[model samples]
Target: MTDFPQKARAAEAAMRAVFDATPLMRNDHLSGLHGADIWLKREDLTPVRSYKIRGAFNAMRKVLDADPSQDVFVCASAGNHAQGVAWNCRHFGTRGVIFMPVTTPQQKIDKTRMFGGDHVEVRLVGDYFDQTLAAAQDHCAEVGAHFLSPFDDEDVIEGQASVAVEMLAQMDGAPDVVILPVGGGGLSAGVLSYFRDVSPETEFWFVEPEGGASLTAALAAGAPVTLPKVDTFVDGASVARIGARTFARLSGVPRERVLLAPEDRICVTILSVLNVEGIVLEPAGALAVDVLEALRPQIAGKRVVCVTSGGNFDFERLPEVKERAQRFAGLKKYFLLRLPQRPGALRDFLDMLGPDDDIARFEYLKKSARNFGTVLIGIETKDAAAFPALFAKMDAAGFAYRDITSDETVAEFVL
Candidate 1:
């Protein structure tokens, strides 16, 4: 029987041929905030800017070693995993076909192509990921190419265990708690499995994006269940379903240990880390850090390690991230107002603004009725509590308005 921990150590050793171990650095800022010794497993520093490369490289390495002539590989990914497979294909001088959803960002598509160079052919497929995955699988069967499962396969899980191996070797002392971000559960399962045997004393906290709480749902059903919908904002970790193989390892975990991070709140963490520490974290990558405050009581006065999963952030999304952060912080809001069509109505509303409240957006939507006009407005305030006072003032003045910031349909179209 293969000693799993020993196998993990061997995997770690083999990974050195592809890329050096990612840094496990003490985060003094986080330690101060949580009153604990906090560290970050910087998987963002890897060649593909994510730890997906670790599993991709390990799985490919074993396959190639077994049969050198087997050089064709296939995968479906909208981001990190595609880049991982692409980079390894080039490194190993193999051919790879990567299928990605048509909605994938151009930046991610470009990065994958750059990493793969001449060795990888990227196929833009269906609007949804499931279709893309099916296309990739069908292509693999037709072309006799090996299909690489992002997290389901045994070899990939074994490959991911290298993260636990490195964490144990890098940390100065045993960690009281280890926080992990979950998507399809590749990294979480691997890390948990390794620690279960090697560092049984360490407590685990697993976080998933609230919109894609596949792990939490799986735990609730005691089986893998698909989320009806997922917010793609946290693209890196927003999987609709947890992998069956990964869930096998994670099923025994207590449901309470699994936390869900709100999508907007994750944006706040992303902006905070970037502004405060100059760490550019993608939304999904910030999952572990975003939940630190909730776990403060348990982690206080103890050693904690939070894995900063990835950093493949596109600068184009900065505005959206900042906007989400502002909304989550209660600093920004959108509203629909009923305005009198009279010439002085706009001036009267502007006069009601407080010293700290500023108009961010103002537009007349319709004025079909001569007496009243439909207006769209956005307001920004210095503090969240200021909203109540502003609303009260508007109410007293008989200014009719509906807060549309939380209205999904209206916000999607107007805001």
Candidate 2:
């Protein structure tokens, strides 16, 4: 364990053969927002658009050096890790069999294929990641190929520690606080282990998506336990269970230091950074930055570092991201209204709306003989406070409506 820092430094040195160190630059925009000296460690700018490449490169390099004749590698990933492994397989001129869940986005699949070219074969297996992982392990055993665990392997963890090595070397000294995004925990574990050995005084905070709080669950249980379900919206950081090896290193983390970033709230950060700073970040990539507001009290007047984990966002999901952001901000809502079937009913309803309210969607379900109709409507407004006045006007006019914005069942069907 004493020589771990030496080994990590050596790995950092070897990474130069592949790509230069990602930037650790002060973010003026975020600094102003939180009143803190906020710096961004741009792991999103890597060749694979993520820090996953660091671990993949280190693990594959060590394997090939130890056994030059080894030619095959296998891994299961939904996105970033597969690309990292694919990119490294091409660099090392080895065959890689990559497995991904059938539901993975076509953009990710294409990107992985583009990175590996002739050196990789992609297999679309089970609908869920767990099933895909099982298939990958079975295939690996049958072919006698090395199976690469994304976060559990020792070499991968050491490779990930390179981020910490580069960070400390690039900055004047250890930061007052270092916030990291957590998925299966490889990046956090590696960074924590290295930082603890060299800069023991630095404070650390971990962020996980609210829908997939694997680390939080582990801390409470005193061990890694699989979650019955996980939301995949933050695909890069949505793990059902924290890795066993990673949990061993991170078990000491206090519950307070592990923050949960709600999925919709994260969408707000994603769009804010993209529009204001002209920086693109995926859901998981924005986790660390999304929590800065919550920690403003503690981080103000201090030097803080936030790791932007990945930038491999599909632009096709932009609309969904915008909608989520609006919803979370209370700037948009959906409602089911019961309206009189008489003429000029919609006009009367429109008149009740404030100057800033705009109807984004309006549809009448059916007109009944009872002189009333069911209408589906979506409203967008500049301020959340506008809703109260609008509802007051509706009540005075004897208008009946149901706010379906938070009803998941109705939303899934109508929205």
Candidate 3:
């Protein structure tokens, strides 16, 4: 009954009032793919469709027990945190003032409202989250309201530890390896703390979006360092800086265990879990699972548990997710080629197609040569190795081309 385990058990007890334990089901698909016993701690099924609710619920509960009549709780978030806070306010019969960036998606805003109902009021302010956060803090100060943070709070970290408590019980014991995604570090920190106390033998694999690998960067530098720019593709786990208190708990962890999941690779995993396993996960939620491919050798025969952080996925982005996945796996490609205008030239090029290759997109820009035209083509194929053969045929046929499928700058503008 160390302090860490005590805190986690208390956190788990508090959460039972809102929602029972989320499922910790063994995933057959993942298990077969990785050659290991794979299980998923489905935090995605939490009340706010994320693990954020644990922190929000525990923090608010503590506040209420102290005063029993705290009026308004203020928070600034346009993602899962906002929804979690709103839901907690409603549950506690307290008022919530949420400040969101004006650019926040209608889906998120609508969900937050739906969760909080009349217990919450949303203020759309600022163009970016930083601005909205500042506004929310100032307002809370002026009104004497408690400004709850998404992370960066010791109480919230303790609240998040509840996930580990449920995981241990649900799994019937400790897992050999626990894959946790690191955002602002509240969930990872809390889970790590709980394991430190009770299951020190368990290994940890900390995952983060490659575009925003704050924990990885900090480990490399031997201290926290700010990222120049962060990609918000994995919004839940994309943090420019790790929490100070959280980094303190996790600072001594081995750097080799921290993994960076590429954004496009994550999109592929998200789509795979959705289609193959009938499980929907946000980009961040898939981070831990996606790293399994990267750590196949290490986890080959071990019992592994990956935290599926959240499922607040917007289905409207499915097409984009598929497009990204195809690009990353080399199942799709874009090329700019020189095409001759001669009568038999187009027919000659068409004859070079491989059996598995499919033309997904084709367009012609202005002719670049007197007797030739610049043609932009998009190709899809069954395998990545098919491209080299396709290119060989195109070269032997005397057609010149450049592959631009992986050129981010070029892809952004033309593709």
Candidate 4:
């Protein structure tokens, strides 16, 4: 345990053969907003657009260095980790079997394939990640291949520590605070371990998607526990259970230090950074940044670093991302309206909309009777405050409506 720092530094040193250290630059935009010196550790800029490569490279390197005859590697990942393993397999000239959920985006699958080229074979195994993982592990045991636990393995944790190793080297001094996005806990565990040893005074904050608050659950239970359900929208960090080995290292963290970023709110941050700073971030990548609002009181006037975790975002999901962001910000809404089947009724409803309100979707479900029709309306406005006045006007004009924007059952079908 005492030699952990040395092992981490060695891993950092070994990484130079594969890729340069990700950038750690002071972000003036975030700094101004938070009243703190905010620095972004741009892990999203890695060759594989994530820090998963660090762990994959290190874990695979150590395995081969220890046993030259061990040439086969197996891993299950739906996103960045798969790409990282594939990339490393190509680098080491080893055969890698990468398993991904059958539902994984084609964009991600393609990228993983492109990264590994001939060195890796991707297997779309199951509809869910757990099934995919089980298959990969079973295959590894049957074939005697090296099974790489994405976050649970010791070597992988050490490799992830390299992020902290580079961070301390890149900065003038230890930052007052370091914000990390928690997925399966490898990155957080490795980073927190290294930082606690090298820079004891540096404070740490962990952020996870609300839909999959594994860290928070673990901290409460005194052990890692599986979440009943996980929202995979922030796929990068939506682990149902935190890694056991990784959680062992992170066990001491206080509950207050663990923040949950709502899935929709993360979309808002993704769009904010993309449009404001011209920095593209996937939902998981935006976790640390999204929690800034919650941490503002504590972080003010402090030198803070936020790890922007990954940028392997599929542009095809841009519209969905935008819609989620708008909904979260209260700038968009969906509702069912009962409209009278009379001439000029549509025009009257349109006229009731404020100048800033725009109808994004207008569809008639069906004419319930000869006198009335049920309509689904999606409205977008410049300000959320405009909603109250619009609803008031509707009430005065005897408009019967049901706000279904937040109704999960209805949204799942119509949205």
Pairs of residues at least 3 apart in sequence or in different chains that clash in candidate 2: none
What lDDT score is found at residue 62 in candidate 2?
93
lDDT of 4 by residue, 175-278 (tens): 99999999899999999999888899999999999999999999999999999998989889998999999999999999999998888898889999999999
Go through the candidates in order and give the clash count of each. 0, 0, 0, 0
How displaced is residue 185 in candidate 2, in Å?
A: 0.2
Tens digit of per-residue lDDT, candidate 3, span 202-305: 99999989999999888888888889999988888888888888888889989988888899999999989998999999999999999998899999999999
State the TM-score for model 1.
0.98
Model 1, residue 299: C-alpha shift (Å) = 0.6
Output the better candidate (1/4) by lDDT: 4
TM-score per candidate: 0.98, 0.98, 0.96, 0.98
2 or 3, greater by lDDT: 2
lDDT of 3 at 158: 94
Tens-place lDDT per residue, model 1, 135-195, is 9999999989999998887778889889889998897767889999999999999999999
Alpha carbon deviation, residue 151, candidate 3 (Å): 1.4
Q: lDDT per model, in order?
A: 0.91, 0.94, 0.91, 0.93
